[model samples]
Target: MSVVQAMDLGLTFPAGDGDVVALKDVNLTIGKGEFVSFIGPSGCGKTTFLRAIADLEKPTSGTLSVNGQTPEEARRARAYGYVFQAAALYPWRTIEKNVALPLEIMGYGQAQQHERVRATLELVNLTGFEKKYPWQLSGGMQQRASIARALSFDADLLLMDEPFGALDEIVRDHLNSELLKLWDRTGKTICFVTHSIPEAVYLSTRIVVMSPRPGRVTDVIESTLPRERPLDIRETPEFLEIAARVRDGLRAGHSYEEEHV
Candidate 1:
């Protein structure tokens, strides 16, 4: 099943006395339960594309569908969960309460809310920290809480925008493994945006490379690595090969942009 489909996806914003084109003619299809990543330079519209799929931004001209429905319809039905760069947790709320907030607003019963919150915290390996505040946790733990909150509602699709960008290298590595485990256990479809080529290669089934200044997808590389990815896999020749391919794709996009300019 195609969980996400983007055809001729384009976005433009109004600049001072002119229009800033963010994305143009981007096409992508993400299969159900697949892990996909968008990788590009700093201003390549990776995040913008994510926002469009999440219904946070309306495309200027294009068609985007999630699960055979429009992005707006999917959003209205609460068919997806979004995790931004920051944890975005409310400081006054405990970890469990933070996870439960969505349930509360969505009108889940108290018992079901508790059950889901507990299970999600466990899913993210934050079971014992339910009562702690976000301020009391480390940066990585806070991001996990945010992810837990995203998963607490049991949404089938997750849209993550550089969720681990703030963490240190060790913490990022730990979370990467945990994320793969979670994906294996839950079978949820994930669209992750990141600038790190290695991170994108390690975590994705496919990597979409985009270019800046009217961003467009230049290449989509399918990962050939086995599904049972491990930390040690990063040091293997296969992993390096895929990473090099993605790097080439990124560089190709940049070269094309320079030629056009």
Candidate 2:
């Protein structure tokens, strides 16, 4: 079923001189338990669109519904989990405490909070580091902890914005695999924003490609690869073909901007 839906969604920011159009006429529907990615150039509205869906930003026009309710309703109901580009952990809090913060704020009992934190830490492969500080972990480990914090709340939808962007290539690969396993286990709907074409293709069931300067979706590609995706899939000809298609979509969008100029 459609867990997230955006209809003719548009966003505009108030600049000093004029309004900056970040997104225009974007429409998308994400299914329950689906993994979707938004990819484009730096100035594209990938992150902006994500924020709109998360109720962190309000669109200037159109409608957005999460799980058949408004973004505000979903957000207030804590229907989704959000992982930002940075780890955003509290330095003073231990890893377990950081994960439990949400639960505590949401009024979960101490016992329930402890159970959820432990389960989520294990889910992200950080089971033993519950007592460690955020500074005590590597960049990748810190990101995993951040993800654990997001998952600790057990929200149905996950909105991730470049959560692995700062990690090294090898670390990113490892986390990508771990993320797929987590998705399989949790079955939550994930909306991720990134600039990496291969990363988008590997991690997403659907890719929403957008353009800059008035970030609008130019293409939506549904991946046909198997659910059991492996690192070796990147070397396959089919993978290359899909990557090329994504690149072409971005290029076409850029060319359209140039033509308009």
lDDT (Cα, tens digit) per residue for candidate 2, span 4-69: 999999999999999899999999999998999999998889999999988999999999999999
Runs with alpha carbons beyond 4 Å of true place in candidate 2: none
Enumerate residue pairs that collide in model 2. none
TM-score on alpha carbons, each prediction: 0.98, 0.98
Off by over 4 Å in 1: none
RMSD in angstroms between candidate 1 and the native structure over all alpha carbons: 1.0
Error of 1 at 20 (Å): 1.1
Local distance difference test scores for all models:
0.93, 0.93
lDDT of 1 by residue, 1-261 (tens): 799999998999988989989999988999999999999998899999999988999999989999999889999899999999999999999999999999998999999999999999999999899999999999999999999999988999999999999999999999999999999999999999999988999999999988898789989999999999989999999999999988998888888879987
